[model samples]
Target chain A: MTMAQMDRLLFGDNQFFGINHMSEEKARAQAMRFQKTDAIMEVLDVAYAEGIRTFMCTTHDRITEVADRVRADPVRYADFRFYPCMPYAHKYANAVTDHGMVGALRHFMPSDGVLSTALTGGRALATKEVDGIAKVLIDMEMKMFHGLQTPVIFVQNVFTDLLLGMGFTRALRIFHDHVVTKYGVEPAFITMNMPMLLEALEKEGIERPIICANINKIGFRMSGGFDAYLDALRSGRVRAVAMSVYASGAIPPDEAIHWISELPGVESIVFGASSAGNIRGTKALVDKYMGAPA
Target chain B: MDHKVRIGVVGLGKMGLSHFAMVNAHPQVETIACDGAGFMVDVLGRNLENTIYRDYDTMLDAERLDAVVIATPSRLHAPMTTAALERGLHVFCEKPFCLDWADSERLATLAADKARVAQVGYHYRYVGAFREMKRILDTGALGRITHVLAEAYGPVVLRPKRSTWRSQKSEGGGCLYDYAAHPVNLLNWFFGTPAQASGSVLTPIFSDGIDDQVTATLGWDEGPTAQLSVNWSDESHRKMTTRITMIGTNGRIFADRQECQVYLRAPDPALPGFEAGWTVKYTTELTEDPWFYLRGEEYSAQLADFSGAVAEGQGKAVENDFASAAQTDRTMAMMIENAETGQPVGAPPVTARPTPARKRGWFAWKA
Candidate 1:
């Protein structure tokens, strides 16, 4: 997909692509292949010309330059704001130490480690460690987001599999045991995978809350594919789907549009791009599937 | 068919199961025998039934395999691999090849003498993206590199019972032995050898007297410095993401293992950055395929590569050759010695501690 097309689609959907730093070689390769940075800015400009809005990067060292570049050129990329991923500890410290509030920040530290090792070998850290990490992370958030030096810090929970695998059995149980029981910080919203997550939250006594269904689950576990995702959203298994449309790389415009057509009850999908190609493709996909925000 | 090779697996622990799975599913490989602790073999019975042996010697004697993949505990890798090489079986063994540098070097000499296929399971070397980074560094994109900051933070693999072999210092159950190999190997890979290596490690959480966390610095021969922070008592389960920032004369590059992105910013007047100009120009999601993300493919690929190398009749050279693992083992030995002796490992003892740094603002919060 052209970077412009990808940005357009993501802009239409209110999303930002956050790229992680692994190593120098892989980073260099991604930069060359994805046509990121200056090349991607040209795409974003074109996307803006084509009427796309709200471009954002995941506030990271690998993409901070572009996020800063866009933010500086307010006339052309005024709406571009970098959205840093959260659990707060993982991304915020790095952002504060490195980026210094180029854009917004979001935290999503799964109580369990990423990738679900608790399932493989019932070997998760104790509840105290979880609380400690979360508190340190939350303090970081309060310093950055609550102080209003930056924009809002959205705490996201993309997948609850790790928590469930760690034996919470539900998201609400995690909330109660982690949030309510300990920190007493009632969640403003909760995002999760399916009804199982929601039911778990309900069982834990979480009241009617804003729910974000992860449509991106289809991309990773696409065996049952997109229809299954839509079915879950429509069937009340998922209250409101927060669709993450990009993985591996941004989907081409055609595939993205086809993907949107086959779904139902998608409240919003967070689309991110690495290049103008992804932006333009995403815009076309959104225009085709989500239509103009009337 | 890509010249399938027959293989036998030793030590069917987690790593063993992973290797067996890799060999069985790999397009050009066959795992002949899977041997391990009695309970592990019994549980994995029949599924791994082509050939399974309880005794190590019997398995080595009976299995006329092209190669052997050893995933036994750290203590077993050396002896097991040495025996396999002696028997003319190619070997692909797990890291730290041996606890002692002397033993590892001995194995290296044996490997050279045997002249067979041997390869260490430094599986990180086979990571597609990491390989790409090695290529870029080889091309000198970052210029004359000076300093590198690396971290390997995670939870203690040895559990509360403290009965496992991993919890004993005598058996290589320390943070440096278990976790430091990654950065140490990378350092060796990147900047030849260090002129001097010093480390300070602690075992705050575990009662096993093995270090749970370590901070080590290596001064390279080429005037470059590398710092490593490792912990076995991490707050989370495990995260092996290594963050490498190369300080070069012309420009600087920072890479994060989790995001799989590289940020490069050269000296530019237009850009508002310090003398060490920092900006992230490139970003991308690493392939999160379950097979790849779980490191299943890389493990499989290592087997295939090792088996192929063995099939080429270079068994002794293809697996656990020990030369590479020895550098890390030596560095780790230094770390352990320093942690215990209150002096740099392998260095003359000093009565006084070095000048301590001023307590920083973060100290209070951490406290």
Candidate 2:
């Protein structure tokens, strides 16, 4: 069996969803700018043309349209892959409760594996609410990327940090096991505190697990401090994927990318930029600093 | 003080649960949970490996807690906080410290007398952009701020909804205490307690006997004037959007949760970050990453500060301390009185109060 190769540079979905950690003005403006799916696809196309094969994104509602377009036109995006992240958990449970299991499965599940997924729901429905909710979220969130290449699934920061804080790290293993067994894909964790998570994952018997976190020169959102991250990366115990490499535009492209390229174990960099010029410029920086993508 | 601060958390509403999660997770803290709601306590107890209590006083008595975090409804803050302080426990209470100004003043003095770490959850002070605003203002980059605009709008009550404690005048103090108090507290942090607050209006769009919108004017003796416009009913925004814009003689400074925009007519060598024209600095640039992040960095940051203050023991002044919150509470009281009497309250003479020696162009807002 062979594992899918992780792309060195991945385009991110934050720009499409108006998630600017820096500027609300820019977030709101870009949100309005990318209201239509075409605008998002156009940027994705630019990223794809510039040699970014992977799209790391949250399972937002609009992603269905993008998936449909990608699935519809396989020739244009021949090597396209998705790294789908989970969104709001409460919203998922609400959907299941409001629409009932079967009704929500209709709205949420893609046609290909609906039968088996819904059948598993019977056993899930018998479990406690918390366990049931997690199942519903994973199943529904993955439903959008039907018949697409999803090499990696991510547990969002909110869930990852909460579990990390609560010391319920056993759940991380459950997530990894479920994603691997069910989807036949690797599960990665996105967290603010990469050092803590690396320890947590290692304790859970997951070795060299891909963990993405805020890694930048200013150390903007890289929790557990820069020294800890440097130690973790230098030791090569975890498969590191650096996100927020630009620190949300705080650091310039050449400066941020060059700094990240020097890190020991970072295997990927994920970024979000709306404009084609930005996408091209950042891709050029990544290639220049870290060599061309595999 | 105990090496690991033993803490008890009371009231497990939304904010309470989150605070409990962070508190229970702290490395330097051993925390127990309490809530009046039996179901909440039971649920938390079943999942989390911690002692849970149904009564606040019972938890305080049973546990040798050095501190307590009060995240109850707004009405219960004053009593809960007072009880915790009386126990010689450091208290970190949720915002709108008290619905009434007198309670705020009383509690402020009580916390001072008791020598306990008293902090209110005005988490905005932890936000990076706002902190940048403070840093610039401290540098005297925006010289002699004259006029200001403070606004907060959110899509909270878009249509008529059933009233909960949140929508009630008595329990939550409606929009004035519950919603507008956020920006108002930020105003207090920027300027000293306003000498006068006037032209206050509290209007309801979707709730009865409570305000969903608030508008008012605040003034300081030094010269800076400010307007407060907040509406929770506005649907244009996705969430609560608080912004402050200051117009000064030297330049203008504007800040929100995400970014700070600074303008200087003639840039000084001392202020390297800002140019002669508009320079924008973002939250990403200003903030350090938290050891743990929940909701946003600010939420975890506030709890971490409270924990650190508790560990440091008495005389460790918190950033958003009870005294600082009392200033905001008093300002709200002035606005409420002005609204009732159709006249300005606490209006100082339209002239100079004897300027303090420290009141140079540097730290002008300190006065």
- Evaluated with TM-score, which candidate comes out highest? 2
Report per-candidate TM-score of chain A alone. 0.51, 0.86
Residue pairs with backbone overlap in model 2: none
Q: For residues A157-240, write the lDDT of model 1, one tens digit per residue.
A: 422333321223343343334443433333423233344445545655654433443455336423223454466556754334
For model 1, the superposed segments whose C-alpha errors exceed 4 Å read A1-245, A252-294, B1-3, B46-49, B157-161, B236-238, B259-297, B312-321, B342-367
lDDT of each: 0.53, 0.82
DockQ of each: 0.05, 0.36
Q: What is the TM-score of chain B alone in each candidate?
A: 0.80, 0.93
Task: Show the lowest summed lDDT stretch of 10 residues, model 2 chain B.
Answer: B37-46
Q: What is the TM-score of each candidate against the true structure?
A: 0.54, 0.87
Summarize candidate 2's per-residue lDDT along B1-367 as a digit string, tens digits: 5579998888876678778878877778998888875433544566667787888888877888989988888999998888888888888999888888789889888888888888999999998999988888878767778889999998777767654677777886578887789899988998879988889998888787888899999998876889999998887676689999999877999999988999999886667767799998877677766767767889989988888988987544468888899898888888888988989898662645544656366567555
RMSD of each: 16.0, 5.7
lDDT of 2 by residue, A7-80 (tens): 78988898887777777887789889899999999989988988898999888888899999999998998899
The sequence of per-residue lDDT tens digits that candidate 1 reaches over residues B17-42 is 55665565444566665564443354
